[model samples]
Target: MLSARQRQLDRVRTFLFGSRTHYGAVFTVFLYALLIAIGFVYLYPLLFMFVTSIKSPEDLLNPMVQWVPTQIYTENYAKAYRVLNYPQTLTASVVMSVVPSALQVAVASLVGYGLARYRFPGKGLVLALVLATFIIPPQNTVIPQMLTYKQYGLLGSPLSLFLPAAFGQGFKSAIFILVFYQTFLTLPKVLEEAARLDGASDLRIFLTIALPAAVPAFIVLFVFSVVWYWNETFLTVIFLEGGVTTLPMQLSKFAQAYENLYPPGVVNIFDRLNEAIKMAGTFLNILPLLVMYFILQRWFVESIERTGIAGE
Candidate 1:
């Protein structure tokens, strides 16, 4: 009976503490708890924003209301929608982000492929320059670029944003370049050699053999580029301030725009701009980004896995 009890105790310990083959029940519970804690930390702000956005003015004023509102009030969204000029600004944002992202990805891929696959004069210098560009703050270059754009009459036009991307100089272009470079470096060169032996020209070999293998990298970079471009406000304000208005651009000036739409003296105090309305605007500003992220989340995970940088 003593030996049997000892064996039962050992089995229970093993079940709780895990074996070489599998995790234990305790570990699984702890891991899930940690994940839930981390998830809450990241999701709290979004939850607060969404809840606040739907709160009525009365709920906002009521001290009793914190996480949950008494009722869902959508008036804030209606007011915010008009203040943001959602339809027009959303279109502009999509154009601004997608166009530059496509151009940036294309340019980065070529630059990365060249850096990874070729030996050239001043290769070290070129790489050093790309890294330097990545490290350098955009503030240092924005004024000069703005002036140049003004001089060339490209200011406030999409070309002002596009030209740099087309030349592999878009915002965070260096990172994407490095990503592709690393991706290409990992690819087996034997395929390229085989293509070459088959009488494929350099460009043809790259197009047929190398580019297809780097599709995952391309998707990852493009998605990230789109997010960066979509969220960029500083350069957009400097270059496209007068001519175009993106969601971020409009969001920054939400208060002023709200006043313009509904003057304080003309409207009742309850109808005036409030935190709920501001939260609504903020939520609207990020809604598209959330949608995009959710839709492409699987692609992002898969691409990251394929790029072999998931651990990184």
Candidate 2:
């Protein structure tokens, strides 16, 4: 009898929330349309770049804006390479961005694990400090960090860039810590209790039980790490010197070089080259991230749902 009544309730609720209620279906359609509009707004530039990168110089310079390339000259990518300083700059960026980011994620996860799992006297205080750090502007700390790195004989080294990451000691590291803490807080308590009852040590519980449950949070952290590191322009500039410059630094260099070599609107291939090269550089810089996001968007979305907010 209860089951039949519950079924009727479900049907009524669905009907009300679906098309039966005033303008329910219209709101749903509007939401979907809004989402599509936003998606196009975000992705159109990347799409434009993919097409623009392959266009012949003549086609790109054509009087009217053509959405599609007339003849896809694949060689423009190679030509753009000369101005981009492709191979070396690419390698430098990968090392500068990727290495430190991985370190930050590791350190943040480990620190968060300890804080979440272990009962400490001043856990709240420590976490408050992390939150406080987040509120502080990074620009204020950059000079001090530079001075500290210089004192440690680590100046101008890649280690200088990654050392703070290793220690969970950078601007973004604080954000990671808060995120990990929040996610870890949402994990079921019984899992830890069960592990303890089974003669599992704290270390074993954290390593085997807690960490396994936090995979969603880990994925989110991984995404943040890779994207933040890849896009970080300021840290790359201050810590790194000429030989160890990142793509951001290299982009700035190219901009200066291009300006010095040619006046704007001169119409030479080399002169107009700067415009396309900038676009190509942006394309190359963003493509890897776009690919990663789309490929893992399902995981990203699933993780977001599990990240405590929905359940809360």
Candidate 3:
């Protein structure tokens, strides 16, 4: 009986402690606990924003209501939607983000492919320049670029954003170039050699062999570029200020817009803008990005895995 009892205890210990090949119950639980804590930390703000956005003015005033509201208030969303000019601003934001992203990716890919596949004079200097561009603050160049755009009569036009991206000088363009460079550098050279042996031109080799292998890298860069452009406000404000209005831009001026819509002295206190309404506007601003992320998350993850970005 003592020997049988000892064996049972040993089995229980092993199951809780794990073996060399498998994690134990305790470890699995601890790992999940840690993950949950980290997830909560990141998600806390979003949860607060959502909850606050749905809170009624009364709930905002109620000291007892912190997390849960007495009732769902959709009036905040309606007010925010109008203030943001949701339809028009959403369209502008999409165009600004997508167009620049496409142009940036196309330019960066070519530049990266050239850097990876060929030896050329001043190649090191070229790379150093690209790195320098990345390190340099955009604030330093904004004034000059703005002036140049004005001189060329391109200020407040999408071309102000497009031209730089088309030339591989978009926001964070250096990083995308490097990502592509690393991706193309890792490709098997034998395939390119075989293509060359078949009398394929350099362009043909790149198109058939290198391009296909780098699809994951392309997807990753485009997604990143889109997100960056979507969130960019400084350059957009300076360059596209007069011509276009994005969701973020509108959100920044939400207070002024709200005042215009409902004069504080004229409207009832209940109709005046409050924290709930501001939160609603903030939520609306990021809602499209959330939708985009959910839709592309699978592709984003697969591409990241294939590109091995984290490892690099």
TM-score of each: 0.95, 0.80, 0.95
Worst 10 contiguous positions by lDDT, candidate 2: 267-276
Ranking by TM-score: 1, 3, 2
Tell how far residue 36 is off in model 2, in angstroms: 3.5
All predictions: root-mean-square deviation over Cα?
1.8, 6.1, 1.8
RMSD of 3: 1.8
In model 3, the worst 10-residue window by lDDT is: 303-312
The model with the greater TM-score, 1 or 2, is 1
lDDT, candidates in the order shown: 0.92, 0.74, 0.92
What lDDT does model 3 reach? Answer: 0.92
* lDDT string, candidate 3, 110-204, tens digits: 99999998999999999999999999998999999999999999999989999999999999999988888888888889999988998999988
Candidate 3 Cα errors over 4 Å, as ranges? 310-312
Q: After superposition, how far is residue 238 of candidate 2 from its true place, in Å?
A: 0.4
Clashes per candidate, residues 3 or more apart or on different chains: 0, 0, 0
